[model samples]
Target chain A: MLASIVNPLILGISIGSILLISALGLAVIYGAAGVINMAHGEFIMLGAYSTYTLQSTMGMPFLLCIPCAFFIVGIIGFVIERNLICYLYNRPLDTLLATWGVSLVLMQSSRLIFGSDVKYIAMPEFLSTNLELGILNFSTFRLFLIAVALILLFITWFIFYRTRLGIKIRAVTQNKEMAASFGINAAQVYSITFAFGAGLAGAAGAMFGALSIVLPTMGMHYVVEAFLMVVTGGGSILGTVFASTLAGEIQSIFAFIFNDTMARGLLFILIVVLLRFRPQGLLSTGSGRR
Target chain B: MSFTRRKFLNTAALSSLALAAPNLWLPGAQAATSLKADSPIKVGLLFSLTGSLAVPEEDSTLVMQYAIDEINAAGGVKGMPIEPVIVDAKSDFKVYSAKTKEMILRDKVISIFGCYTSASRKAILPTVMQQDNLLFYPTCYEGAECTQNCIGTGPLANQHSFDLIPFMVDNFGPKVFFVGSNYVWPKESNKNAKVWLERSGGELLGEEYIPLGSSEFGPVIEKIRAAKPDFIFSTVVGASDIAFHRQFKQAGLKVDKMPIASLTTGEIETAAMGAEYGAGHFLSAPYFQTIETPTNEKFVDGFLSSPYGKNGYTHYNMEETYLSAYVFKNALEKAIDMHGVTDVTPRKIRDAAAGVKVEADVSPEGLVWIDGDNFNTWLKPKIGQCQADGSFKVIKEAADHVAPDPFSIYPDSGKCTADGLLGLDGKLKVDLI
Candidate 1:
């Protein structure tokens, strides 16, 4: 009985961390910039490809590739913001379409360059093993992911709450015109915020690429869940975290009772039901900012 | 004027005469060397160059070209140079159907070689049959299908599972778990394995199917940990195979203790998943890159030297695709001899494919022959254990070519002969399940 209970919970937490990591980037972008960011998954895919290039071609250590992926994708995100996204700021629908087009370009470009074969990202020797703690037996890499997710969350929290840029970002997210009047340079804040969020996605991709296979279309798999956590969480970081954990546990419990397919189907149904009841989502922002 | 009974009989008589003694009856046999020095026999190379199926299908496409080039270098098939009319199906089933029509009706290629998934093959089946064209499919599939329009050169369901299941049961315990991608191929392959498992008195602990391209194996892994099955019979294909192996490794399931014996994990997948993750896991295929035969060695060396050899590993899919071109070549030669060089059509080539046989020298897999009765090729099954060097080490192999039994699960199995489904009508019949 204890094994049964602990196993699902541990599995739930493990999957929850994966969900949270993947959702963090989308949440950050939607929360701050109010951009739906259709290319967020591609940004994550680019991060994985960046990590793959670094590790495979450059022979960089896997631990170093995560931050490198962040900066690499972050730089790319900065360029995209300056060139395209900056043009369609108040035009949310246009930004959505343009970012989606950007995603298609990125996907095709990666296919051409990498040749669409699945590539592997090697992890350190220690992380490949498992951790057995009585009834709580799990992958060490999963535990590492949990730790990484927490560290990332804490850092993002620190950045958003404890920094001067955080104030500028929050101010801009609340009122772009007012922040521009206050000399905050709301456009610059949006660029930085978008880059940061993309960097977070890149970081997630580094871990994810190591976690699974790397392919040109691997982003499509994670993007759905990322969007789910973002939308259901009302586009806030804390809300995403809570929603992922809750969703993971619920999925785990359902999977434990039934099977993975049924669990996934039931989870989608439940999410639909949840959304129908609460149109503003599980946790709505108190701020009256669109 | 129409496809009259007298016209059909005459065509059939001519084809049978050609099959019996092509060298004796062909008046063009003497003039063949002078007939087609400039004119080339066009064959369609239909494969997905983009989308989800592109990765594996890329090698298949390359190997098809390599085989065609090799055939052309060897004095061409019946003194006519073969030209490939390549087209990307874009990994869509509808595109496969459209391309089949376009290749048959528009380009008028004699024969086509392509398709990795059974769905794509099924999509093109009606078009091929309706247009009386031939499609040479090269992917090992869950075989409950037999058709004259398509010649399957890959291993059938029985060819893969018959030997592997018994081997697993004898080596490991009797408790087996079935995991596959939720699709027709996996489900059918698993169903085939279940039949074999029952024959060996093995118990199935659990059977589960995950959606295609899924990465989260945690819930499934948890269930596996709880069940403690002796071995896992995985049919998970594509990129998902990489995650399944990595997470299985991370979940502390030692291959020595409880191995993942799979049908889908090949050289490309194993290399991409890493040797560390796949080491000690088992796979069953008709061909592996590590096979120590002169034919396979040459094939591997030639593929690695090719422009499309960047991935640097060859598996059964490529080997089969390569051999399939040779199969088509041999069949087309007979067809050309039967209907003369200029008069050869897809219908004539499809007729000749039934009697075509390729020897060991040209084929990487030894001595593959298209069954004149069923239009499926005979294949040798091999069980390989994944090594730490990202290659599979052949553990066991069939001493002889295993004849394909596509409908082995049925009591009236193998009844669908060359005359087509149930040996009654020559119409296309696919997917028993």
Candidate 2:
């Protein structure tokens, strides 16, 4: 009984970590720009596809493909932001619709190129093995995911709190006019922030593609959870981390008690209830509206 | 007002000419004579060409085209060319219903062949029945439904589970666990599976359902480990299947120790996962790509060489869809032969569609025919182990074609109970009531 209880808890933590990594990018972009990027998931999809192409065509190592995916998706995101998203800034509704349109185009483009067939990236042999702890056994790939999530969280935190770019981004996010008055180029800051967020999504995608099937529409699967995490976390980096971990643990526990379907249903209900109480979310940064 | 005799005579003559003019305008005799032998019989081809299901359903469309090409090449259906009116459902059920209705009412298609999923079929079923049209649906599904207007050219749950459960018990162990996508097909199929488990003296350890499109299987994997079931029976479909297999393999669960037996895994899934991760998983289906026969070889070669088969992965659903076309063609020819060309209607063709035997050569599978009673096809179920080359190696096959039992009423002892054992409260209580 103890083993059963402990195993699901561990699994839940792992799940939460994955959700955290996937949602971090959305939170960063949405919180900073107040642009609900509907295409964030597609960015992740592009990252996964990039990893697949690199590994298959160029025989690139799986480890190397992670950064490569980030860079590739980051460049794509930068271009999209400059050409499309920049025009719709401050117009949230238009931005949402535009991003959605971009997502559809990306999905169709991928289908045309990849032919709608599912693809998989082979993980390293060592990572494929399970780590059998006393009464708790989990896959190393999941452990790696958790570790990556932690590393990414730290990196994101360091960037925001410790780096110069982080200060510029936060300034622009908090008061764009004030930051511009202070001689900070808010446009460049927004562009860099969007690209960085997309790069994070790309990294998440690389991890996810290894974990699941890579298809044209695979982004939709992760995007929902990512959005939930962002909304529940109140669209902040630290808040998202907390929300995802809580959500993941709750889901696993509920699933363990009931079933997977019921767990998901219950999770949604809980999120709704939480939102009903705290409309601003678990942690409100107030960076969204302005 | 009519005073003169000449005026009255002219009025009578004009009235007679008006009556004669109606007859002259009506093409009653000419219409019959104008029945041209070269006219094409329009058939609606409805399947998802875009969206999530496009990957698998696209192949079904290709197979339909392949069948149409072959039939037309061989002097058409009774020398009248088959004009395919194709439409993409886009993986939406509402769209499926609208398309089916439009094809029947607007295009006046003689018959329609499409729908890969049960949901889409159910959506279009009402329209097909109400419109009194024939729909040839070709995909193995959780069957208890029998509709006269719709002909199922795929195996039912009974045909697959009856053969599959026993085979797993005999070769693997009596202990089993079940996992599937949360849907009607998986839920109903698992219910039947529970019945089969009891009949074979096998014990069901646990059963769980993940939401459709769920990628995470960590908690479920842990649960399976704790239960220590001898084998897993997975009905998880689409992207979820890929996730489950990859996770199962990555978690170092050896197939030899506890292999997975699936109803949904096929050539496409195997290819997607590739041999390294996918091999050793067991699948039970009516058709496999690796079937070695002269006819199958030719069909496979022809399809692969065709432009539509560039992907080089022909799934069981594709073959089933291909077989549906031939079944429709055979029934169409029979209907035309029975009722002369002018007298043929949807009802007449549907009546003739019963027990339509498709020769072994036309289908990759051998000796497929529709059962007149259930409207499901009589299929030979085969157990295949995935090979490294993204193909199935037939480990076992049924001795003969298993008759379709959509209701599973036959072999009354094997009848499924209402309890699907889907409750998540605890492990399944396998004691037979």
Candidate 3:
């Protein structure tokens, strides 16, 4: 029995790792700019597509393709911020609506180009093969994803607390108007921060693309769940990570005991209960409610 | 609107260039009005590529394109050429309605080949029936959507599910429990299983349904364990299946200890469940790449050779849609050949379909047969268990072959095809098989 739970736990951990990676970027965007950029998923799509185009089409190796996919999508995110999300900073929900329209356009464009069918990214031998140990098995590519995600998570923390760019970004997030009065480049930081968040989503998508098919609207289920994950994880990097792990573990156990439907139902109920108790999150350091 | 032949030629040349610019626009499209006038054949390749249903839908459309390639290469119906029109339904019923209307009203397509979901099929039938156009629905369906206007390329659950019961009972002597998503497909599938069990004198320990897309299946697993049923009959779909298979694997139940006979479990869903998550699960479907047939052998080869399926997929619909295109081609040719007419219409194709019979190389069984509703019969299902290496083993035939019935298993119960279902109790008055 103990042996059996090992696999689901690991699967949960993989799901949690990506959720945390993707959600933290959104958390940072919110923490800095109160705007929820709904097109964040499209950036992820862009990243996956970029990876697929490079690795599958241009025949780039998986190891080299990751950074390329991320940066390309991040640059696109930056362009999107400059052209679209920059001026809408003051109106949060309006930003949401605008991003939603942008998301539709992006989705439509991808469909027009790729022809509305799901596309498999086709991982190479190194990323696709698996390692097994007494039923607690892991895919080689998935392990690579975890390693990358963890490294990024640590680097993000280090930047936030120990680096100059991190300090400036934080200052803008803490009090954007005050930071502006102090002559910080708040708008540039805003653009950079939004692009950075999108970069994270793109990275996650590129990693996930190896695991699943890349459909244009594939992000719908994960996007909402990720927003919830960010909130439950306390809306900070550490908070989001903590919440995602917590949610992941709970979901695994419930799914282990109940089934997929009941597990999701129970998890939803558990989240509601947690909200009633903490209102902000279990590890929350912020004022907002997710 | 008067035009000289020179002007018409210039206008046509420009339009052809525009259509030719995007090669992917119509994969198997033929542009030739070089023949006689007053007769046309329009073919619709309908699929969901942009929206929610694009995942499985991509394979359907791509494989259909391959079939159209084979048909057009063989010289289209009466050699007048095949015009392949694209319809991206995008997973919306309203969009499906509007596009289908456009296909019938505007394009005047003689036949349509697309749609995966039961709801999408149901939504399009009224429009297709009203316009009296033929539709070839190429997806394994919930089994109740068979109508005069539609010829299903997909298996109804009964043919696969009922056949498996007898085979599993013979091989494993296992007591059975039913588990599936709480939806129409599973509900109808369970109904079919119940009838078969009743006929076979088999024991039915329990039946249950979980909400679709739910990730927690622990309590149900516990109940199955407690009941100590020897096996499970699962009708779960897509992601829910991955979650279920993972949980069951975690519970220390080996495939041999408690075998699973499943309806909706296929290569597409199994592979997506990932090799580790869904390893060693059994499925019953019309065609398996591993099914011993020269045709199937070539099909698997052709699909893998293509860049789209370079990574390898257990796409059930891809095989079905490929065969369906062949089915469409044969039916159209038979109709035209018999009548000696160049002007092909939907009515002729539908009439020709009734008399047309074609054999499939891809079918698990040797031949493909079509009943009154044009649902093909030759491709009976076989059991295939997923292997650790992410492939499947053909567990041999449940019978020499299983038959498909589009309406009620008891066909007479649906002289009243009221709402695509009979009343409660599900007691069909006829045996369609």
- Shift of residue B313 alpha carbon in model 2, Å: 2.0
1 or 2: which has the higher lDDT?
1
Q: Report residue B407 deviation for candidate 2 (angstroms).
A: 1.4
Ranking 1 against 3 by TM-score, winner? 1
lDDT of 2 at B171: 88
Docking class of 1: medium
Q: Check candidate 1 and list the clashing pairs.
A: none
Query: What does DockQ come to for candidate 2?
Result: 0.60
Best by DockQ: 1
Q: What is the DockQ of each candidate?
A: 0.65, 0.60, 0.17
Question: In model 2, where do residues sit more than 4 Å from their true spots?
Answer: A286-290, B1-37, B409-433
lDDT tens string, model 2, B297-343? 89888889988787786778988988988888898889888988877
Q: Which 10-residue span in candidate 3 chain A carries the lowest summed lDDT? A: A116-125
The parts of candidate 1 lying over 4 Å away from their true place are: B1-38, B412-414, B423-433
Rank the candidate models, highest DockQ first: 1, 2, 3
Q: Write the per-residue lDDT of candidate 3 for residues B71-105, one digit (tens) a residue.
A: 66677656756667887887798998889877766
What TM-score does prediction 2 earn? 0.91
lDDT of 2 by residue, A129-202 (tens): 88777766778898899999988888888999999989998898888999999999998988988998899999
Q: Rate the local accuracy (lDDT) of all candidates.
A: 0.86, 0.84, 0.69
